[model samples]
Target: MKILYILCLLISTQVFSQDDSFAKEYFKNGDYEKALFEYKKLYAQSSSNINYISQIITTHQQLEQYAEAETFITELIQRVDYPSFLVELGYNYQLKKDMAQANLSYRKALASIDENPNNVFAVARSFQNHTLLNEAIIAYEKAMVLKPDYNFNLQLAQLYGEQGNIEKMFISYIDFAEANPLSLGNIKRAINDFISEKSENENNVIFRKIILKKLQQEPNLLWNELLSWLFIQQKDFKKAFAQEKAIFNRQPESLLRIEELAAIASNENELDIAKEIYIFITQTAQDANTLLEAHYNLMQLETKQSSKENYQAIDATYQELFKKFGTFSQTLKLQIAYAHFLAFYKNDTKKATSFLEKTLELPLSELQKAEVKLELGDILVLQEKFNDALIYYTQIQRNLKNSTISQEARYKVAKASYYKGDFKWAESQLKILKSSTSQLIANDALDLKLLITDNKYEDSLQTALKLYAKADLLSFQNRNDESIALLSKILNEHKTEPIIPQALFKQAQLYEDKIQFDKAEANYEAIIANYRDGILVDDAYFKLAELYENKLNQPEKAKALYEKIIFDHADSIYFVDARKKYRALRGDAIN
Candidate 1:
């Protein structure tokens, strides 16, 4: 009997092996129906290889045969002692979008309280995907409870964070980090982005503080990155520099960190620290990138307090940097910084022009050329050479029609024209720029346009009054050119309004500001001679005489006008000042 049983067992093994090979071939040919036929033949013979059972469900799923698939998976779940195999049935149901069955399978698999991490994770993922979040949370909890050292806490933390359940994320991070502190990188990165974004929301402050405390414990995680970012946000750049220095110390081989430290130090007004960092980076890096960045920062540091010193320091740095690293494209930044320092701060516009033009021979892109041209235009405008400035500014406009830089260039061109006393042309440029897309630029253009737009009629007295008032407002804002341009606009529109005398007086004063003594004297004298009985006549006669004598050296004409104001207008307020200045100009020494 024993020999017969052994022979039957051997025969059964051979038959099952044959059925398995047939099933494999059928599955390989994409014939799920034939594959199912062979697999079921083995299954009917009481051969329950878990893989065969799982493949049966998978084949049925592929054939959209869900009802038959559920029966096999359900029985397999009941009969299989392998927790992983049981957990897998849950996933198969989920694949069919049968959430109800999937949920039932996952819960059933976990019902034994078998503390297996892989099974717990599988169930958790299924619950998470099926929107059974409470069940997913329980699975994650069970995962931790089964094996506290498995270290999937970061995953759980992120899951909570994704749902905006920040308090849960915080608590999970704390507990997870306490369990495995060395494994805090993902949690640290998540907390970094999360707290950084929500740092300003009042309700999230305490939550951020919790993360910050964790960050404090793990100083190696992102101490410098977070510190530097925090200081930069607060505009406390000096502190950012200090933090960057610590980062450089921790990673001394990092030339990039050294360069960043130097730049941040300079922005913070710690020029000495900036210089130290720059010198160190340049020595170690010894390349064009580090050297040029350091040299540029040195120039900026010197320029912070003194322009003459700024010029000397920038010139020295540029010559040395060019000698060392001029072959690199990065050297252009050094050259550009030095040019700006020379033009605006040092007021050595001739040197600024020279430095900027030298870059013309270098390989510069259209955008770079546009930037240089804009700076050069600013230099020319500062020198009171508006025509040359217009050429540079217009070149940029022709290249980029509707860019923000083009809008800026147009604005500068109009500003230069205003300074040159070309009120009409300046006003035209402003009208277009007032419609610019950039808000701040548009607002400035609108203000300047309003300054010139006061004279709506070029030949109306009311327009002249409005223009004069606009000039006064410009003077209040310290916009001297716009003020003077509006004054000229008023003069063109002056048609004997009740305010004509005041407009003429303002024009004389603005011309004086321009140091156009001859024009100032002419405007003052015109007011006094043409509007003798005008309210500003007494004041105009006094001013006209002062300009003629003090600026033009015509004491005799000054004496004659002062005498007219005192003798002809006895009740005028200028009687005292006019008589007093008249005596002084004639060498009377009246105090």
Candidate 2:
């Protein structure tokens, strides 16, 4: 009797497996009618299987047998009292274009949410699958109200976004973020989708208004932070600083956010506001590191805007900071920034070199000393002391072997050699750096290596390559006008050489920096017109398009150029950014 019972159970299990396999294969192949038949057979054998029942209903709907699907789904609802079945029934009627029945069924689905709030996900998901977003929203809201523990604001925000309701979407996202404060990063990502370059955009305006209303109702620190983020997005650093101040006052936290804002403002050339913010940080910061950073940034900002007339004052400011901060290992960055300012801006490499030497005498670790030596090497290069610069760079490389700084030092050694007209040695160093662990170093090494090798063989004595290297060094020394003149010389003197496009591209960048837009545009256009087959052609296209769009305010020409990049340079590195800009300019709905 026991053996007979075991044989019967094995037979039953085998039959069920066969039916499941048959249904899955047909469904995978889109043979919905056959899949429905097999699933129904399986359901008849095991009426308690929810998976089998759901598959049967979905397959019937896929075959456009809506009445059959509705009948099965209604029966399933009666047998199990599950709310999601009602959603399926409504979707069936919806597919059949029976609006009255669909409305009634959807209302029934929402009404069932109170019976079992935990089933809300299934009900809402079913409606979403059928594109009945409003019905989905109602189901989720009803469930959340019935059970206060049920949090579905994240889903609601996504659904609202799909419905083009930016205000409601942001509100739902804010609610979710407030409930789950650890989800701030996720919330910011969702909100950024609706933002744009134009602060006056409808969605942007709506989002700002919603946050402002929230702030007015109950001035939460989160609201202040969000406002700071929005202002940063709008590139209004002054307003962002105000919001940061509000946050700091309300919470009395560290000045990290203010420091970051100051750095960004300085990077964007909002110097006056950045200076004010840095001053505020210098006053407010409690940590020694933060205070030192604030002071260093202030001096760096001053140096960035310094001229020969104001160099003395800027030098004095650095000296004062150093006097107050002292030359400990912790103050290495400040020391390096001061040295760079002296060498590059004040034209006092003698003092800069001496200052760095004294800094190296401090109690320092190997890496800290390596950093000082790297800056010292840069100063030496500025003073045309190529051999001395190479000595420092090589020492760092030998000491900190296999480190990121070592890779940087190796690249600088190659650059110094290139500037000294030692093409063979520079190319050799760059060859080994092509596979460097640090991507920035690798890229710079490859670029300089290419500039040397590509142009060195063009002339027997490498005259053009040497001149280009000198121009690069001059540019590095902040002699932009002289660099531009030298590049222009190469353009006129080496007409047939392959280096002309590169020289034109470099000179165009310098002109752009000088705010000589017409000359820059002419140079970019010359590259496009004359060297369409060159490697820099795509770069020319992108830069020219940016100039027309931003500086010249010619949208049509910019659009045409972007279109060219999209079609012709599909495999270029700038493809993704070009596509994004093109879509934004074409007025596509970004989110």
Candidate 3:
């Protein structure tokens, strides 16, 4: 008798499982009638299973049988005494457009939360689903008050942001961060939603005031860090430097964060503030390595902004670094920088090559030697010595197989081959590099590969491609005027070819580099108007938008162009940045 009973129980379980699967399949396929029938069978087998009961009600609602859904939910509430059923009942009434009954049911749901604080999440979620956000907020607040351990500040902040209540959002997030200091990273990420483009904007002002007030009341170090972050985002490097100094003063371990801020300032073109920050680091850094790097970076910034007349003084700065650091492997980067400066600015490739070759004799790792060789190869390329440059690049590729440096060397080889008019060899090398580990190298490889493959087939002798290659080499050599003229020839002669757009875009870039904004704008506009369906359309749009926003101060036009990328070119690489710019221009703080 016992064995027969166990077999019957197993058989019954198998039958129920099959029916549950059938119910889910019908629900997924939107066969609500069949779903309801199956769910009813499941409910009869296990009347206490809330899953089956809920599915029965939901299927009825999905089928627009609201009266049936209400009847079922009412019976379930009576049987189970569950508070969440009140919310489900309210949802059904909302679907029926019975606002009075919906409000009553929703109130009952909230009142039930007072009796059982654990029901807060479900009640709030239901209210949120019905778009009754105020009630949801109340439910969350009530839970927090009743149970001090309850923390739903994240949800509250998001809801407050949705309502555009910036102050409340900031307060909630700040409170949450203070309570759970380990979650400061998440809090900062959340606060970024309310940061405006302009630091002086209302939201920024409110945030700054709040942090400042918090500092007065309680000097939490996290406030200082957050303030520093906010200043960096606003590009206020001076203020950020001061805050970072405060942090270092309190901790006194390293100047790493300050060095990073200096780099950020330099990148944003705030050269003066960047120089000041780096100078401070050079003077105050306790470590020799940090001091050396600071000096090197400071001189690099000066070199970039220096004129021909200023090169001698910059040269003196380089000599001072060499004197201080000596010709060691640690000074390899400085040595290479000096080599480039000499080769390009001072126009002395012989000295540059001779100096780099000397530095290669230093006690160095294989990677360090490859670094020096790479720069030397670049200098050789600058001198149009393709064969000599190829020798160096090939050495690196052979020495460091499948590494990032190897991929870089391979790209240089392809570029040098292209420059030397060996299009076939260049195309072959580029094909391998199309999957390079380095994104910059891979992108460059693909661009050069397309430039060759697209134009090589047009002329067997590769006349236009050779000219374009020479133009590209000239541009690399900083002979901008000649590059522009050569590109112009391509445009005028190859008017009906695919290379015209490429030429136009290249020349536009050259014009922008020379600060001739009007000509650059015209060229970009021509590409957009002519090559609407071309691969370069999105590129042209983004470039033109940047020119208008930065050079011409026409934010409206820039916004429209950015919107085009957001709406049309969603697959373009520039979509994320374009959307950010668009939101900034529209004065939306949530970007």
lDDT for residue 558 in candidate 2, whole number 0-100: 88
Give the winner by lDDT: 2 or 3.
3
Q: Give a tens-digit lDDT track for model 3, residues 361-450.
A: 888898999999999999999999999999999999999899999999999999999998999999999999999989999998998888
lDDT (Cα, 0-100) at 429 in candidate 3: 97
The CA lDDT of each predicted structure is 0.68, 0.86, 0.88
Looking at candidate 2, what is the lDDT of residue 264? 90
- Write the residue-wise lDDT of candidate 2 on 7-124 in tens digits: 4445655556655988899999999888888887887886656567678888887888777887777776666666667878877887898989988888888876777777687789
**Model 1: per-residue Cα lDDT over 1-591, one tens digit each:** 423533554566555665588898999999999999888877777444544665787789789887787677667556545454445566677777877877676777676445446667546665565455666677777767777666666667767766767778767775676676665565555554444222244324545466467667776535455556555543455566677777766777657755766666666556776776666665666465565666676666666545454457657766776786663456667777778876776667788899789886678888778888888887776666778889999999999889999999999888777665566787899999888999999988986676566444544433453456557646634466888777777566656445556667776787886788887788887886788876667778877777776678888988898889778988876887786666555544112
Highest lDDT scorer: 3
TM-score of each prediction: 0.45, 0.89, 0.91
Q: Cα RMSD (Å) per model? A: 23.2, 4.9, 4.5
Q: Is candidate 1 or candidate 3 better by TM-score?
A: 3
Counting only residues 3 or more apart in sequence or on different chains, how many pairs clash (N, Cα, C under 3 Å) in candidate 3?
0
Report the Cα lDDT for residue 451, model 1.
Answer: 52
- Residue 252, candidate 1: Cα error in Å is 6.0
